[model samples]
Target: MASSKPKPDPLSIQRGDYARTLAGPLLLGLGRMVSIPLQHWLLTAHPLSHFGIPRPPSDGVLELPLVGAQPQLSTIFLGMTATLILKQNAWIWGYCAERITVPFAFFGVVVPAMYECLSALVFSYASSNPLWRKEFLYVGAAVHFFAAAVELGSELARARFKGRIENRGRLYKGGAWGLVRHPNYAANVVYGAAYGFAAGGPVYALFTGAFYWSNLTGNATPAKENYLAERYPEEWEQYKKDVPWKMFLGIF
Candidate 1:
């Protein structure tokens, strides 16, 4: 008889896991360093004006005067970078599995760096032009911050629950998980939408939100559920009964 292949260990450190962890902070940090100056230039210098990019008249719907907007934008970027770094560290140390491949690590680094660059560009343009009311910016920023908190908190809560000796091989259905099966994924969608809204307006927010929602629901969430079902068949079924919602509470 042929020997059975070894089962994968979630706790086992994989070849690229450490590199992925390191790359996340490095790329995000670099992006933050670049974004601040880039945004400042876009907001103050109007460097692209010669290219015929016209600025729209400010209608004062949460219109942040240019002077105030620069400082606020800087603060937003700073907060976002800090939050991302913290979240990255939390996932690596607390929740990440051996499934983090080198390609995935590379993807993670490139995407976040690109997002930071794009955000700096778009937000600067929107701030100058005053698209879709200014109040939405404040609202979006607030929602983004809130979603970040929830994401980080939920991840930490689950990590802590998993760390207990008695809880080995058990499922965590407490904290934010009690509210939704995948609170981190839910928060991810919210934050993406909120960030897009803060950057460009409602249309951008809708696009970004839909993107995250589809990616999570169609891919990440289902894969995770499948893994959990295989690993903890009894617990997962009961947990599903207890918490019917996957991401959102009332919808989905």
Candidate 2:
């Protein structure tokens, strides 16, 4: 018999996802203690969440996949279909940006939005504790859904006026842009943290917050800055003064 190729070391296999490797099991064991109490404390602080706690999101937004679809879909069946299609459309267009929208509209506007949506799902599902139906599964789903909605909404806001305006590809300063420099990105961080909550360990949230935020901000911000300078130089410079939140870290 031919000799079998050597198996990859488990450690090496997981090196890229260090949080899942070194810290996942530990978080799994501690997810309940960390997620439940913190959730209670945080949600109870909000009148709406506290009131809704007993009823269990009658909208069943958690079960829904679009995660970001407007609750306005009205009918139950149509709503679900719309959400899935919308999300899938975003995934397809964003993924295929390389082929469409020249000079800038495609990649910068789409890729970051799509990556975060995927991350939301990953974070939500990965952190979820199958045993805790509501806490991990349902809750995790809700968090990611909200996360996707926020980013998509931001992207939509950014792209909406683009086609109508003379300079469709120009950097903007309105809607979410009105809220902060990167309100969408800031929301991504929040959703990512929520994914960690579902994952069960506060540690997961910390690692994601610290590492991913830093890297994405560094990469995207510079590119965006460059794009703004190249496309809307003066307006882009002023856009900074009006909205200075970096990852909504402080300026949300």
Candidate 3:
């Protein structure tokens, strides 16, 4: 009989694993950088305007009254907002890549991004409108602050969500998470609403808010809870008892 092929060395396999461990994070960083220009163009430039839609009057300038008075400030804020969006997009993409299962995973990744992209596109047009009142800028600023608060709250929840350490996972039940089981989704709700507020119209508000709500209630929240339930059955039971609502306070 032919001699059996030599067994692969376990140490070699371990070394390969070690070498490839940083690949995910590295690619994530590179992808974020590479995507910046495209995202900027999509959000600010209104590339689809050539297809019968109106574009911003000029590049990188919001056509709104005082906002257009100082183009640089508006541009800086726009860039910052877009950067935050890209960062969040990368984070959720990573989450879906790692945690989501098939048959539903594709939907999970695409839906949330579409909601955000729609909001951004609407805001681009809304900001480009010269008809907005000066006071509405204050409204936009206030909503921007609210969105920032949601972001900060979600960050705090992430700090508390120390997951699967040494294969012994611990459920987060303090801070923002204490108020709602899905603080992250709540943040996304606030974010979506803020975008609507910034856009400043009844139609945009309804569309953006509905899309955001559907993403959380109809998509992300259920998928997240399902995974949480499977990953930490006992802890998830207790968590539900302690925090009844999935995305809202006193109501879901």
lDDT of 3 by residue, 1-252 (tens): 899845433311221122333444444344344333544566566766766565433323456565444343234435545655455555544432242223233334344445445544655565455554334434655665666667665664464355447433676777778888887777666666655655545556566678778867986677668768877899899989988988889779
Pairs of residues clashing in candidate 2? 31-200, 127-198, 127-199
Estimated TM-score per prediction?
A: 0.75, 0.49, 0.61
Report the lDDT of model 3 for residue 207.
64
lDDT (Cα atoms) of all candidates against the true structure: 0.68, 0.46, 0.56
* Residue pairs with clashing backbones, model 3: none
> Which regions of candidate 1 are displaced past 4 Å?
1-47, 54-70, 94-99, 127-130
Task: Tell me the deviation in Å of residue 102 in model 2.
Answer: 17
Best by lDDT: 1
Judge candidate 1 at residue 239 and give its lDDT.
Answer: 95
Write down the worst ten-residue block by lDDT for model 3. Answer: 10-19
lDDT tens digits, residue span 94-205, model 1: 6664445444555565666576657656665664554655667678888988998899888878878877999988988888888889999999999989878877788878
Best by TM-score: 1
Error of 2 at 67 (Å): 20
For model 1, where is the 10-residue window of minimal lDDT?
A: 9-18
